[model samples]
Target: MIGFVEQLLRFASHIPTFHLNVQLLVDFAATCEAQLDRWGILEDVDIAIHYISEIVTNTSNGDHDKLQLALSSLYRERAIYFGALDDLKSATEHGPKPQALNDTKHTSWPSKAIHAGRTYLAHGILLKDTVKAQGYLNKATDLFEKVIAIGSGNIALLVYVCESLAWMCELGHDAGAEPRLRRHLGSYLLTDILDQQNNPRVSTGKHIGRIGFCYLCLFKKGSNQKDLENSIKYYNIVMNSKAIDKRHPCRCALLIGLGHAYLYKKQDKWAAHCFKTATLLEFAIPALRMDACFSWAKVPNIDLVEVYSNALKIAPQLAGLEYALSHRVDNAKLLKNLVQEATKAAIAGNDISLALMWAEQGRGIIVAQMLQLRIMFTHPGIPIIQHKEPELADSLRRATTSLHQLDALMGTMDVKSTRKLHRDGVRWNHLVRKIRASEKAQLGDFLCLSIEKILQLGRKRIIVIINAHGDGWDALMIRKGDNRPQHISLPTSNERFSSLRKDLFNAGLRERRSGDGASGTTGSDNTSKVKGRAVKKIGAQPPPPPTPDSILKIILVQLWNEVVHPILQELGISVSTILP
Candidate 1:
């Protein structure tokens, strides 16, 4: 029965309804355990469970994909076991009689257990069930505590286990266990990243910041002073590493994590100092900087506006013509919070035009990726290049496809994945530069619209860009003579535009929409973004708050009077008809 349930779980995870099915499986397993207890063989179940585990281990052999699946196997299996045990404890009307002394131990379980525990840890952190989340987290802590002790200090075993744990920590679980295993995991990771003369391998610093997170998680759980110190210690060390001291993608996460550790340790001044240093790092992603700013604002007497203003000032960088549509989407979502803060700051400073530019950058990520950029080789606009340089076009088409497919992944990268991503990023940039350099390509500007270019677009006619901010609306108008954008606070709010960034991205326009007032401002929210919320069935819930035709129209009419009418009036343009 245990083996059958485990196999069922392995298959179930690949399906959409796995969570819905888990409770039923847990109940069924409990019933089977109750029957086993009646036969005085309930305690032998652990042996059967581990026996199947050995078969799985032997089957996985040396395949990496198989290894992760094995980890996922243990993860789901233990969750089932724990659920069944809970069923027994519930004293349900009819439930399993689980054996009291249930030990989940076996040789070579350390690495497998840690891997599975990490997946469970990610799922737990993301789960909305606070009670259930905490329950599984405790189970994981106990599981890690038990298995980490069994393995002797083989450096390979220690390094693999430590790498898994550090990345798991970076996945941001609200879990910290007793200090011993965490320190062991973090210490091994730090061993590789710290400044050392004898170590032949140069650290890319990709996974090094994760070590700080491992120790931070430890400090959270046990309140161990040394764990917090070690977290800070490695954070500083990793930051100062020759690789990280300069601009590096890894620095994005490191500064944020370090800020948190300092916050926890009451080193408020050092934490604030991180914000200044982060601001100096030209390449650090804006979204990450926003997070650091929020954390720094926790210090008493600090100006809140000043902190978020820093987030606002960090401009969104172009994704370059080579970036995947999905990558551009990811980058935009990351920049959203900072854009929001920046917009608010603009409102405070009465710099309406500046806020609009920031909002333009934040919304319509795909729009930004394609518009103002020359067409791809397939597009008719680039026919001359495609026909003349057919071979180059083919190379570009293939390389561009490979680059997009490579960077679209949405999970943690081990060292191998990190190297792969870096290579693809490099290769794609090289190809783009090569294409641009070719005289025959005639691409002109294969890039997103520059702020100056966008302003120039408004020289001939009026262009009003409206963006939804929280529950309100703000607008920027560009007229011919006054090259600078003019701001208008629209009279009404429409929630549909709140997700304008996402909707415009999903639209992914085939042709850039032009000759419009507030172009790309009113992205259609025809699709829904439930975002893990339960989807309602037909007639399942009351009618939604009056949407598109009603609230949206009202907002539009409000814009006509408050924004367009005034601009046109100022321009001496006549309106033939008047509206109430």
Candidate 2:
């Protein structure tokens, strides 16, 4: 799965960013690291390391800055793991090399600064030496400030630096070199950027709300009257901003910030009012809600069990919920409830893959693995070696279990445990290699065919992949034997598509409501005949006027006419004679 996902990511790197989900890829990478570390397969760890490095090396012709960021992130993760495992030599070796930033032509200065800061931050966290840690932290802070100063026009870089700095401060690694209020200079700078942008009402409000969070951080750090005053000022700006939408998540965050500020000012009534208003908001940001819950918990008298419970029911992955529950409530039943809610939330969020990954991490590894096996075996177009060689599946499962057990035992790494892990890992690798060889023979290919290979299968044929990008859709097409995929631009832009999607959703809601109304009137004898005719009429309603599928077909036809047909004509396909 890791190898397959890596291939997809590498392929995506060659395409436009609209077609890729970078955060999803990062989450997958994190999952891979977590699973590999949990299983303690030292051999496969090297394979993963090599695979990620290969991505970095192969992506030089692509987006250099994004590629460098990804490479730095991977190195940072590896270094953190190695340091935690007490492998100082490997940790140092895995740390981002300053030489990587020397290529000014290929690498942007912002990218270099961000990567260097991240590297130093990772090292500072992992290193046990306080003096070295402080030095690294200072260096990181300096690099971040440099990027913030130089990359003012680069919103993305500025955001990354500011967020990283905020997180570093939260981790208490800032070394207290700067004054408490001045420590968050990056945050204030971000506020300036937000202030300059002529953004929409809701967007500007959200930006300002986030800036208010920076002041909240200062208040947390100092707890002085001046800090409290500054925090209140920002919170008031957010709350009074006419640009804020009532339903915006930023409104919730601002209220939460105000709650904290009020709490600091020892105004329990105002604090409670802020917390209550925040919780009542139509669209609550999960992180902010968690903070609100934590704040309410700190109050001398208040009941938040219902709030936390219901909030978790909505989004169980909300940060700080677990900690508050563990320390404040500490009930096993509640924890179990949280786990169940999280599992359901993951599935509901259209991320079944993440749910399965979490299941393996938690209590149901075997169950999740079995379910995955069933999916793989039953899924069309997917090759499964388990059907042809059942013994191979059994062997693989056993090897995996053994690997996990060994990993658990070797968590506290030492020379003896390390050697044992390596030995077992080698044995595991031999089994996997043999299985892969056999599967290759049976399946003819170990993974999905590339676009180039797929295009080679037939003449005068095109393989079109429709991808959803935010509110829009993009079609990538490859004609037979084509060297590159052609992008087919649709006539309908993202904003238009978004409006159409909303219309479809509203129509669906109306249909459901009408169905419910009919259900309640089913037994009325006078209306039975009317209901029968109504049902017949509805059944014959010409396939429900322009559903989302039909809308997409319209766009597809537009694409075919506007983009693909021209290319086909250029390729001497005789489009005049070709039939739809």
In candidate 1, what are the lDDT values of residues 71-170, reduced to their tens digit?
3343333333222323222221111111211334544455445544544444454443555656545554554555646643344334334444443343
lDDT of each: 0.52, 0.51
Model 2, 301-334: lDDT tens digits are 6544444433432232221111222222333343
Clashing pairs in 2: none
Stretches > 4 Å off in candidate 1 = 1-107, 125-132, 151-231, 243-249, 263-338, 372-449, 493-559, 566-578
